[model samples]
Structure formats: C-alpha cells, structure tokens
Target chain A: MYELTKVIKDYHRGREVVHALAGVDLDITDGEWLAIQGPTGHGKSTLLQMLGGLDRPTSGSVVLEGKDLAGLRESEITAIRANAIGFIFQTFNLIPTLSAQENVEAALVPLGVSTADRRAMAASALEGVGLGDRLRHLPSQLSGGQQQRVAIARALVKEPMVLLADEPTGNLDEETRDDLMALLEDLWRELRLTMVIVTHDSAVARRAQRIAVMRAGKLAIKQDTRPAPAA
Target chain B: MFATYLRRELRRRSRQVVLIALGLALGVGLVITVTAASTGVKNAQAAVLHSLYGVGTDITVTQAPAAGTGGPGGFGFGLNRGTRTRPAPGTKFTSDRLNPGQLAPLADSAVTKIARLNGVAAATGSLTLTDVSISGTIPSFGGSAGASGGSASGGTPGSGGRGFITPNVFGVAGVNLTQGAIGPLSSGKITAGRTFTSADASANVAVVDANYAAQHKLKVGSTVAIGGSTGKSTSFTVIGLVSTASGSGSDVYIPLLRAQQLSGLTGKVNTIYVAAASATEIGGVSKQISTVLPKATVTTASSLAGQVTGSLASAASLANSLGRWLAIAVLVAAFALAVLLTISAVSRRVREFGTLKALGWRSRRVVGQVMGESLLVGLIGGIVGIGLGLVGASLVNAFTQPLTAAVGPTTGSATPGGSRVFGGAGQFGGSPGAGPGSAFRRLASSQTVTVHLTADVTATVIIAAVLLAILGGLIAGGFGSWRAARLRPAAALAKIA
Candidate 1:
C-alpha cells in the first residue's frame, strides 16, 4: 500500500532551519499495521503527516500505490487524502457546532453521498465504535473517551484505505487508552486497514505488527513483532 | 450542511451579529431620513418657483429699465398757479393713472421674433402695471384766496396747507387671451366663471384674483372701473374669479390687447413668457432667446433656483451637504466595523475550518461558508435598517414645520429700483398715513411662498437603499471570505486554538 524512499522534510523557525525529517525511508505492505515511537519534536508526527499526504516533503519521494504523493498536484493530493486516507488527532478536533453523528457525516460529505445514505453510514460507523447512543450529543457534552470514539467513527466512516493516527489516546486515561487501543486493533484486523499510529507509549507500540523507532529526525531501528506468516 | 453550519455558527455568535446589525441599521436609517428631507426641501422649492415663475414656463424674458426712465414719470396735474382764476382753497382734486412702473417695454414684434426662434415651443407677452389713485382736498393758504402752484409732478404738500392726501394702489397683469399656457394666469385655477377667451381679446373683460375679489367684495359678472394711462376710467366686466396657490398673482387680469390700448403704449409688452418643447432644451432655448432679444434678461429655471433664499434654501443646503456627508460617514464606519468583526470571528474558527478542510472540503467551500454567514448577517441588518428608516422618515414628516421660500433679489443693492413699484406711501407722492393694502404687499416683485414640507419616500429610493444595504453586506463578506480562503489547512490545524 505504501513505498517511501529517502524522504526529507525541513522547517524554518526564525532564520534557523530544523530538519524535521532527514533522509528517512521505509516500506509497508498492504493491510499492515505499523507504529512509530519517538520522543516529542523528534519527527514522528512529521513522518506520519507525510505518509498521509497532509504535508509535502522537501526532497525524495513518498510512493503510494506507485504514485509519488510528494510530487502530486495540490488538487490531486487533496483528492487522495479525501478518498484514501483518514486522520485521527490527539485532540479529537471535532467541530464544536456539529453533533457526533454530524461530525462523522462530515467525512462522507466530500464523497458526495446523499444525505440519507450519509446519515445511515455515519450512524453505523458510530455504532461500530460503541457510540450509537451518543449520536446526537455535541463533543463538549461527551467525555474524553466518548469524544475519541466519535473521532474514530469520523475517521472510518468513509472506509479510507489508510488510517493515520497521531497520539490518538494521548488525552485519555490509562483505562480508556487501553480500551481505545483494543478497539483500534480489532478494526485493523477486521477491516484489513493499513494503519500507522504514532505514539510515545511503549505498550501502544507493542500491539503493532511492526515498530519503527525515530530518533533525531531519522529512523533508527525497525523490529517485526509477528513471526513470518508460516512460509 | 451549509445551512446547518451557518445557522449554528450564527447562533453561537448572536451577540456579534446583533452588534454589526445595529451599526448598519443606524447608518441606513439616517440615510433614509436625510434623503427624504432633501426631497421634501426640493419639492418645496419647486412649489415656490412654480407659483412665482408660472407653470410650464421654462424661461422669462424682461428688459431692465433705462437709467433715468424707471421713476414714476411726472403725474402731469397741470394746475395753474398764482392766477385769480385758480380754484379756491378747500377744493377737492382726484387723479388716477395706470402705467408699467420701473419696467422697460419691449416691442410687440420682439415676442413674435422670439416665438419663431429655434427650440422655442411657445411664447406670450404680458404687461405688469400698477394703478395708483391719489385724492386730496386743496389746502387753505393764510391770507391768500388762491394757491400758487408749479407743475405738481411730485404731489408735494403745499406750505402751510391743512389738507390730507390719500393714495390707493393695486397690481394688474395683462394676459394673452389666445395663449394662456405660458403666462401669469397659467398658474391660477379658475374658481368661478371663466378665464379670457379668443373673442375677449379686444373686449373690456377682466379676471379677478380670489383674494382680491374677496377683499373688494366683488364676484363674477361684476363691473370694476380701471383708470387707464390717459386718466380715463373704463368699466370692465369681471368674467372670472381665479385662485392661485399661496395667494400669489396679480389682483386683476385683463386681455393683452385691451391693456396695451388702455396703457397707451401700443404694441409693447414688459414681460415675455416662453416655454420649451422639452425640459432638456431649456438652456439652448434660453440662449437662443437671448440672442434674438439681446437687451432682454433671459432667466432659466436652474438659474432661478440659485437665486432662491429663505428657510427652505437653508434646509436644502443642510440636507444636501452636511446630512449627505454624515450618512456616508456612518455607513462607511458600519461597513468597517462589520468587516472587522467578521474577520475576527473567522480567525476564532480556524481549528473548525481546518478540520473541515482535512475532511476534504475545498478552500472554496470553506470560503463560501464564511461568506454565507456574513451575508446572512447583512440581510438581517438590512431588514432592520429598513424598518428603522421608515420610522425615521415618518418622524421627520410629522414634526417638520412649514418652510417658507423667498425667490428674487437677495440684496437691496441687487434689487432694481423699478421693481419697487408698490413702495411705501408718501415716497411716490402719496399720503404719509396711507399705505398699500395687504393684497398689494404680497404683490411685490420679490415673492415669498409658504409651503408645508412633505417627506415623500418613493419606491425607487427604497429599492436603491435596499441595494445599498446588500452591497454593504457583500463588501464585508468579501473581505471575511478572503481571510478564510487564505488559511492553509495544515498550518491552521496546527494552531493551539
């Protein structure tokens, strides 16, 4: 599902250049779950953003299904993000004015789904996340765990091929975080979704099929947790 | 989705919406009130002008009196002085004369020439004359049976005389019998009987003003004796009673031919009233008439509007200058405030907008949402503003007083001496105690008309005001949308709030 080689990302912070992603590359197969672990400001989120086509690399190529996301036009990149990729933020950035069902429906809006179909799909997605009863509740009215469930429902409503999560359970308690991780693992295995999760918790990283440790803007090591498929 | 999002967002910021709407409402309301007032003042001026300048008359042509020819030429009593045959003291003498005072007469052919000029639709001539009657008893001189007299041209009182003099004065206008659409009587409405007809061109007929008729206790078909320039009285049948607005116009109206014959200035007229075929051709026609009659003073309506004075003129100036500028200033401030507040609201919604963008919403869609919200606010403001504007206009019409407009010479020096035909008594050989009547006082060349000002809010003005409000909304929305459109989703989502 993805092939990246020698990707580099830079940022300008008041006349000083910060190499957020320096000469890093990795490849992942279809339906694979990969977790990137790093300290704060160590380019883990930056690399995740590049893989999701949310940010452009300064140099090198990030290939997704034989197309370089780094070299694609702005409109083409936007379409790819709309149709193929879903994002989950630590803050669960739900529109304050929209309800849980509406927030999930917003993901389907870009796909031009009819209103009735969009409502049905959003409700089903929320139910799958165990949020069927919170469909009409605003984000402010829901607890942190419920809000994250809503965010997860919003991300998976459009059935994107790839799901990129940046510290999805960072703002939740330990119990809620463990439950959210279990739910994410179940969804990944059931739907065969290519999931890339960035987290600082070693326990969250241990659940992935493979783990890559990013240090000082470079990928330092990669470890495979599951045995080779009995070949 | 658009409507839901917009409604929710507006509800969240209801206070800001109301504030912007009130600002816009104040601006629009003031604009409507000022515009209505300006229209009212303009209408009042037109009414005054119509009364003095005559209806449908686009231009007037008159000649200034020659340097020495404007005065009341000698009365010519021709009394013999220091003669034994002279009349004894205590004898009574009476004299009455009708003549064009302080006005130079143009040849009757001048009117014909002007009528034939290019761009001239119609032309008619009029003679404005004053009839003065003086009667007094001969004074008794001490130790003398007969009085010594030179030519009694000035009506000077004899030394040591005990007699008194009385003077009666009134205005008369000679109107064209065939052309009644372009003269003084054109503005008058016939209240009784009928106006002059073609057959009455040479007949001894007269039309009396309603106010003048009421004062003299006269009616239609009554006989009024008018003294001519020859000091001979001719009894004219009063055929009509005409009422003029604001009690303006001559006391009596007679056929032009009869007035010419009676005044003994045959084939001469003091005033020429001309009408143009179209309003747009008034200036050209005035120029043509001036060329045709070089010595005549050609005055157009626009030029006459500049000469108007009094409270009505002041109101017009205020409404046009200060009121207009103030409305514009307030409207501009409102627009600026709306724009600033809308931009601030958009800035506060950066995270929300970024989330939508990440959901694959295009930049245009985000900008459109912001514009829709701003435009809705503007529409609300426009509706409220219209209501407030109508109420303001009503208040203006209810409380405004009747405005008076004076049109003529603005200064005493600019006033032609001949225009003062109805001067104070004793200044023109009249009694010191006797003065002109109220009707004659209003007949002065300088005219003042009292008109009740009305603020008429027409449909066109309302439509334009609405369009202006919409435009204000568009402008504010445009700026806010531009700011929204420039936001990059990646950078916007990275914001803390």
Candidate 2:
C-alpha cells in the first residue's frame, strides 16, 4: 500500500539543521498492520508524518499506489490524505470545543462530505468503538480510555486506506492502553486497512504483523512475526 | 464548512471578537461624527453665502479698480463730506472718491451680452450710490422728529438739535421684486406695505427701510427728496416700508436705470451678479464670464467659502477641513487596534489550525476562515459605529451654532448709508454697530441659521468604509494565517505548551 525510497527530512532549529529522517527505505504490503518502533528522538514520528502526507520529505520520495507523493502539489497531497489516510495523535488531539461525534465528523470535513452523511458515518464509527452513548460528550468530559476510543472512531470514520497512529496509548493507563490496543487490532481487521503505528513500546510493536525499529535517523531492524499469505 | 468553522470559532471566542469590534466601532464612529459635523458647517456657510449674495447667484463679477486710484489724494479719500462738487478722477483731494465714472464696470450692453452667453441662467446689473448725500430732518437717535436740513454735512448740532442722516440707496434691475434683493427688503424683513416690482422700474418709486423711515417720520406713499451725485434733488414716492436687521447695508432701494442716470454714469454698472444654469456648471460659467470680462475679478461660492480671513471663515475651515483629517486619524488608529486584537485572537488558535491542516484542510481554506471571521467583526463594528456617529453628529449640531459671515456681491469695502447693492447683513464683520466678536458670532440670539448636515452616510461612503474595514481585518489576519500554514502538524500535535 505504501513505499518510502531514500526519504530524508531536515528540520531547521535556529542556527542548526537537524536530520529527522535520513535515507530511509521501506515498504508495506496491502492490508498489513505495521509498527515503527524507536526511542524518543529516532525519527519515528517524522517517518509516519511523511507517509501520511501531513509533512513532506526534504528529499527522495514517498509513494502510495505507484504515485510519488513528493512530485504532487500541496493541495494534491492534502486531497490524498483527506481521501486515503487518517491520523490518531498521541494526545488524542480532539478539539476541546467539539463533542465526541463532532470530533469524529471532523475527519470527513476535508473530504467534502455532506453534513447528514458525515453524521451517519460518524455515528456508525463511534458505535463500532462502543462510544455511541458518549457521542455528545466533549474530550474534557470523557475518560482517557473513552477519548482514545473517540480518536479511533474519528480515524475510522473516513474509511481511509491507511490508519496512522503516533503513540496512541502514550497518555493512557495500562488497562486502558491494553483495551485501546485490542480495539485498534479489531478495527484493523474489520476495516481491512493498512495500519502503521509509531510507538516506543515493544508490547505495542509486538501486536503488529511486522515491526521496523528506527535508531539515530536510520531504520535499524525489521522483524516479521506473521507467515506470508498465499497469492 | 467555512461558515460552520467561523460560527464555532466566533462562538468560542466571542469576547475577543467583541473587543475587536468595539475598537473598530470607536474609530468609525469618530470619523462619521466629525465628518457629519463638518458637512453641517459647510452647508450653513453655503446658506450664509446665498443670503449674502442673493439666492441663486453663484458667482459675482467685479471690475478691479485702476492702480494708484485710492489714497489720501486719490479716489474716495473722505467722501463723507456729502459734497456737491464732483471729484475728478485724478483729483488731489483729501477724502473724495473717483465719481461714478471711475468705479463703474459693465455697460448696459454688457448685461444683455453676458445674459446671452451659454451656461448663464440670468444676468443683472447694479449701480451702487457710494457717496450720495441726503439732507433730511434726521429724527435724533430716538425718533423725536426734527426739522429738515437742520444741520449741514459734518456739522455739529446745537444742544437738543437733530442732525442729518444720509441714507444710501441701491438700484437693482432683476431683483425678486416682492422680497427685494438685500437686507431689510429680502423676504421676512419687510414689516409693512409692499416691495416694488419690475413693473415699477420706470416709476419714480422707492422702498424705504423701516429703520430709516422711522427716524425720518416717513411712511408708505410719502415723498422723500434724494440728493444725487450731480447735486440735483429728485423726489421719490416711498412705495413700501422695509425693516432691516443689524449690518444690513443701505436703507433705500430703487431702479437700476434710475440709479445710473442719477449718478450721471448712464449705461454703466458697478457690480454684476451672475447666476449659472446649474451648480455643476458654476466653474465653467465663472471661467467663461471671466474671459468675457478680463478686467473683472470673479468670485464663486466655493472660492469665497474657502477663504479663512476672519473668525467666521476660520470656523468654517475647522469644520470643512481640520475636522475631517482628525476623524481619519482616529479611524486609522481604530483599524490598527482592531488588527492587533484579531492577530492575538487568531494566534492563540495555532494548535487548532495545525489540527485542521493535519486533517487535510488546505492553506487557502484556513486563510478564508480567518478572513471570514475578520469581515464579520468589521461589519458588526461598522454598523455600531454608524449609529454612534449619527448620534454624535446630532449632539454636536444641537450645541453648535451655524457659522455666518457678512458676504456681498463685490467683496468690497462697505459705505455707511451708501447703496450697498447685493450686500447681505454684516459684510466684512464691520456692520455699522458691530462689535469685535461680530466676525465669528454675527447672528443675534433671536435669529436661527439652519446648518444642514452633509454627512448623510451616502451609499458610496458606507461601501468604502466597509471595504476599508475588511482590508484592515485581512491584513491583521494575514500574519496568523501565514504562521498557521507553516505549522508542522507532527510538532503541533506534540506541543504540550
């Protein structure tokens, strides 16, 4: 579903240029659950942003379905993200003013979805995550586990081709984290989406079919735990 | 989508929106109020000018006097002597004017010629009797009814003896016969009897000012002997009585052709009041008239109003010019303040904007949202400001009196009791008994001069103000939108601050 060819990303901080991603090459099969795991500053988040089209690579290219993302215009990249990719932030990143349902519907806004259709899709997505009863509750009113469930519903509402999660369970308790991981796995299987989760936890990485470990702006290791399916 | 985003944003940050709106409103209000007040003053000045030069006469043409003409030994040195000996043009006299011949400009033929010119609605000639002297029984100051010619010109009267009061006479051709052309005769000033008309032009008729008639114990149909510049006395029947207010020049009105004949300067006129076909054509007509009479100095309503030589002129200038600029300064400050408020409000939402970007919202969409909210704020502020401005203008108008000045046809020096043809009340702020403060506050408490406000909030002005407000808001939001567009979604999501 996605491929990165020698992807390099540099950040300008005052008088210094920090390379967040350097010469990264990776590939993911269709409908596979992949996890990129690394320490705090090892470019895990940067690679996920480039793959989701939230940020562009400084050099090289990221390709989805044979189309190079680096060669497209900014608007074209945003269109691809709106239609094919969804992101779940570590902080849950729900607009504090919006209710849970509204937060879910927000993902469909850039896709030019009708209000009624968006509402219907958002309701179904929330029901799938067992948050249908908490549709009108704001993020501040929701529990940590429930807020993470809302974020998952928001990511699922769009029915994107790829679901990207950046440290999804970072702010949750151990029990809530485990529940959210199991919910994510269920969504991955039911929606048949290519899921890419960037995290520092080995336990979260172990649930994925394949794990790529990044260290010092480089892909250090790749481990496959699932058997290959028949063609 | 933009509307929904805007609605939520405004609802969430309504306090900031109100703050910015109020700032803009204050600026727009001040400008509107001041501008309206200034317009009111200009309207009042136009009214005064209309009364001063006769209604409908937008321009006046006067011939400049010959160089080296008026001095101690020149023309009009001490013409108050009421002498019978006509002063020569170049006479080395102490105080005598160049008799009628030197002062007259347009001929009877010129009046007809200029009237035929394009853009000229009407043209009329006037002959002013500047040095005419009349020897009549001047009722002492209090209407005691004294004998005629009891005291000669410049002579001191004996105890209890009444002195002579020389009344100047004005002869006009095309004046509004019923109302008359000048003060004490123009509408509302006539107390009794009726004014003369064009039909009485050839009749030996006269309209005696109420003030002059009261002093002389004269009435309608009474005959008065008017001494001419050629030292001849002619008897004229007082056809009507006219009561004049202070500063109204002259006390008698007669026919222009008779005045010309009386001054022995037949076929000549000293002043010409020209009316253009329309207000917009005044300029072109003035220029055309000037070309026709190159030696004449032409004055227009706008040009006369623009002069700030006296207290009244200064007040008008304040209302017309200084006040407008002051309002603009306030408006600019208000816009700047609004911009700052909007920038602060928008900047605080940087994280939310980043979230939107991550959700695939384009940069233009973000810009549109910011701009939409700003325009809404500006619109609300503009409406509030307009209301405040109108109220302010009304309050100012209520407290301030319409400024007035003494203006006349020629813009020339006024002569006491002389035929001040086309002279309105208080010319040059030196009306016979005017005080020093007369220039600024010339109207009496009993009199009311309506100052109509010109700041009526025209559609064009409203549109322009709204456009300016929108532009200001866009400029302020531009900074925030740029910052939002440059935001890195990954960094923004991780920001805990």
Candidate 3:
C-alpha cells in the first residue's frame, strides 16, 4: 500500500543544511507491518512523517495506493491524512484539557461524524483498548500506560488504512511497554491494518514482521522476521 | 466536541478570563459615565438658552440702537417747555414713562416680510421696554424754585433742602397676540387667569409675571397704571399671572399694538423672534434673514450657545475634552491588555492545537475554537460592564451639585434698566442707562440659574456601549486566533512540552 523512491529530506539550521532522508527506496504490501529502527537524530521519524503525509520530501516521490503524496497540495494531503492515515506520538499528545472519551472522539471530528455517533464509536474503541471505565478521566489523571492506550484508541477509532506510531512505548515502564506492544500486535492482526512503527528499542522492534535500520539519513539494512499471516 | 473542548479550555484558564473581563468592564463603565455627563451638560445649556431666547424660537433679530436713541424718552413733565415756570417747593408731582432700552425699533412690517421668506416657519415682533415711575416733592433750592435744565434730582432732606424721590421700575414685554408661540411670553406658563387672545390685540390688558405679582401683591383683575410716551397714564387690567422656568421673563406682558402705541414708537418693534421650518435649515434661514435685513443682528441657537458662561459651560468643556480622552485611553488600554493575555493563553496551548491538527482538524476549526472562547469572555465582560455603568451614572447624579448657566449679551440684560436719583439738589439730567455697554453688561452679567444635572442614559447609548465592549473582545480574539492558525503541526509537536 506504500512505495518510496529516492526520498530525500533536508532542513536548514540558520545557514547549514542537514539531510534528514537521503536517497531512500522502500515498499510494503497491503496489511503488512514494518518497523524502522534508528539512533536519535537519524531518519526514522523523518521517514515516518513523510509516509504519513505530515511533511513533504525535498527530492523524491512517496506513492501510497497509486497516489503520489509528495506532489499533492497541503490541503489534499490533510484530507488523505484524515481519511486514511492515523498517527500516535511518543508523548501520547492527547489534548490535556479533554477527557479520555473526548480525545478519542477528536479523531472522527474531521470525518464529519455526528456527535452522538462519534461518542458511541469513541467509547467502543476505548473499550477495545481496555479503557471503557476511564472514559471520563482527563489525561492528567491517567497513568502513562493508560494514556498510551487512549492514544491508540484515538488512532484506530476512524478505521484508517495505515497506523503510524513514533516510539509509542518510549515513556512507559518495561512491563507496560510489553503490554502495549501485545495490544498493538493484536489490533494489527485483527483489523489487518498496514502498520509502520519508528522506535529505538530493539525488543519492541523485534515484534514486527520486518525491521529496517537507518543510520546517518540512509536505510543501511533490512531484516525480515517472516511472521505467519493473520488467520 | 468543539463545545466540550472550548468549555474545558476556558475552565482551565478561568482566572485569566476573569481578569480580561474586568479590564473591559472598567473601560466600558468610564465611557458610559463620561457620555452621560456630556449629555447632561448639553441639556443644561439648552434649558438656559430656552429660558433667555423664547422656546421654539431658533433665531432673534435686533438692531443696535442708533447713536443716542436708547435713553429715557423724556418724562414729559414740561421740564423742556420754556413756556412753563418752575413748580413751587414741596409741590407734589408724579410721572411715569415706558421706553425701549438699547435696541433700535424695527418696523412691524419687517416681521411680515421675514415670515414670507423661504425656510421661515413663523416670525413675531416684540417690544422689550423699561417702565420707570418717579414720585416725589420738588425740593426748594435756597428758598427758590430749582433751576431747570431737563435734570431733576432729589433725595433725603440735606443742607440744600433736598427732598426724596421714590422711583419704581420694572421690565415690560409687548407680545404679539396673533403669534404667541415665537416671542418672550411663549416661554411662560400661565399660573392663573389666561394669556392674551386675538381680541386683546388692542385691549388695555396685561399678564403679570408670577414673581412680580407675588412681590407687589398684585393678582389677576388688579389695575396697573402704565404711563405712555404721550405723557398719559393708561390703566390696564391684569388678565393673568405666568411663571417662567428660569425666573427670567418680563414683569408684565401686554399686546403688541398697545405697547407700540403707548411707547410712542408706533408701527415698530424692538426684537423679532423667528422659528425655522426645520433645524437643519437654521443656518440657511439665518443667512437669508441677514440678506433680507442687512442692518439686523441675527443670532442663532448655536451662536447663542457659545455665549453661555458659568459652571454649566465649564462642565460641558470638561465632559467633552478631559472626560472623552480619558475614556478612550482606558478603553484602548483594556483592549490591548485583553489582546496580550489572549495571545499568551493561546501560546501556552500550542501542543493541544498541534495535536488537533494531527487529528485532521482544519486550521480554521482550531482558530474558530480560540475565537469562540474569547468571544464568550467578551460577552461576559459586556454584561458586567453595563451593570457597572448604570451604577456609575447613578452615583454621578447623586453626588453632583446643581450647575449654573449665564446667557450673555444677545438676550438683553438680566438687570432691568431704571431711574436713579442722586442725593443732591438741582440735578436734572436723564440717566441714559441703556447702551451696548449696559445691554451687554446686563445680559452678559451672570444670571445664575440653578439647573439640576441629569445623566440621561438612553437605551441607544447603552446598546452602543455594549457593542463597543463586544468589538473590543472581537479584536483581541482575532489576534489570538491568528496566532493559533499559524501553528504548523510538525513544528508544534516537535516541542514536546
């Protein structure tokens, strides 16, 4: 469902140019899970942003389902992001003022879902992430692992075609990290979602079907786990 | 979801919201107080002008008295007749005469001519007169009759055998019975009996002012003998008693034709009061009248307003200058404060906006959320400000002292012209106590009338004040929303905290 060819992204810090993504080429089939592992300041997050249509590549084309995302207008990219791609940040990034249910409902807001239907879907999604009893609790009241679960529920509530997570378990304890990974794997298989996760933890990266390691703005190596297909 | 998010956000920043609202309230309250005070000052000035320049009269036309025409028209006691000999000492004599002070008479036909002019709604002529009566015993000058030179002065008995001269003086106005709505008597309210009718045009009847009637113990139906320039006293019946609002009307009101005949200025009037068809036409009408009668001094209400002086005028200046500027400064400061605080609040919510954008909410949606929060705060401020304004207006009315206004030179004198007898023997020169100096001094001399200032807070003013507050809020909110709309999701989320 995704293709990348010579994706090169650059950033200017005052006068110096830093290359974020350099001549990268990759592809993934529909409903496949891919993980990118890299050191800090490498191209992992930059590549994820490009795939999610959050940012454009400086010199390359990113094709998702036969449409070139790099060439689309900003508004068109926003529409695609709303209808197809869901994002999960390392910090959970839930609106601090809103409750868990309201945060989950925010994902469907741009989809023009009615308030009543949005609330029902948000509740069901939160329940699917084992957070049905915490719908009314604010982000400040929830633990780190619970907040991550609410973020996951928010991402999947709109039933998007792709789920992109950037270090989702980076802030959680080891046990909570394992539990979050297990929940993500289960959702990926059950919904057949094409998932791409950017992470530094080797243990978390090992759960995906394939792992791509990036170094110094280049994809240096790729290792396939060859996991069984979903039943 | 929008409502929920906005409600929670405002609740989170409730303290800042209250602070901004209070700032707007203080500004709006000052605006209302200053505006009300200005209106009150204007009302007081109008009342004073109405008192001096008859009600409904927009312009007054008068001519400066020619060379030496305004003095006492001779007492006609045969002082100037060479055929009559001096009277014997202690011989009782009485004389009374009515003369027009300081203003030259305009022909009565001028009123008709002016009334026919374009934009002239109505015109009526009036004769403002001074009635003077002298009654005393002629003194013996060194056991001989006093030398006569058109001067007759007497007082308490002294080394020169002087005798007392008692003088009674009062103001009289001849009002046109045909057009009573545009002259001096128009401002009076009849308290007893009735004013003049068309039948009284040639009748020897008069309307006495209430204060003058009260002082002289003269009521309706009392006989008052008024002397004419013909050297004959005409007994006129008091037909009515009228009271003026500013206590500034003539002591007696007589028919126009009778006053003209009695004053011996037949077919003439000293002042012409004119009303224009519309207020907007006053300047044009004044110009027209000036063109019609070039020698006539035409005074409009606006020009007369400039001549008003005293505490009321001071109040008007204060309300217009210092009060207005202070209100504007406070309102501007309030709006600036609100804008700064709103921007600061939006800056703190950068992460939340970034996350909303990532969730596929349009930039306008996020901006709209910020605007909604600010507009609600502004609405609260407007309501609170209105309440504060009402309280402030009431306090002004409660604590303010009654203001005084003095209308100057254009409307004759506040002090009536009268005969003054010197304390010497054989002094007999007429005191021409009416001229530009006397007329200006008399009218310019402060006729202090205590006017109770009222802050007229109308519904329109309140509505405008509220709208002003709301506009302040919209401006502040617009700045905040602009900041919010410019946030890029990628850059915003990069700053984790």
lDDT of each: 0.78, 0.66, 0.81
Model 3, A32-99: lDDT tens digits are 88999988888788888889887789999999999999899878888898889998999999998899
DockQ for all candidate structures vs. native: 0.49, 0.52, 0.57
* lDDT of residue B25 for candidate 1: 82
Q: Model 1 off-target regions past 4 Å?
A: A226-231, B71-89, B141-163, B223-225, B410-427, B430-445
Q: Put down candidate 1 lDDT per residue, B374-490, tens digits, no spaces.
A: 888888887788788789889878998888776665322112211233422223332222222201232455667788888787777777777777777788889888988887777
| Winner of 1 and 2 under DockQ | 2
Write the residue-wise lDDT of candidate 3 on B362-422 in tens digits. Answer: 8889889988888888888888888888898898799989888765533332221111111
Q: Give the TM-score of candidate 1.
A: 0.89
Tens digit per residue, CA lDDT, model 2, B1-497: 46766777788888988877777777777777776666665665655555445556667665634542321111122333323433333333221111232233457676677778889887776654433333333232432222122222212222233333333333222232432443223432567777777798677777776777887789998986654544455787888776544334345667666666665667777666677888988999888887888877677767755442334566667766787787777777877877777677766777777777778878788777888888888888788777777778668766665444543222233221111322221111112122111121112211222333344545655566566666656666676566666766666665621
Best by TM-score: 3
Ranking by lDDT: 3, 1, 2
Which ranges in model 3 have alpha carbons more than 4 Å from their true place?
Answer: A226-231, B76-86, B140-163, B223-225, B231-233, B409-428, B431-444
Please identify which of the two predictions, 1 or 2, would achieve the higher TM-score against the true structure.
Answer: 1
Ten residues in sequence with the least summed lDDT for candidate 2 chain B: B423-432
Q: Compute fnat per model.
A: 0.42, 0.47, 0.57
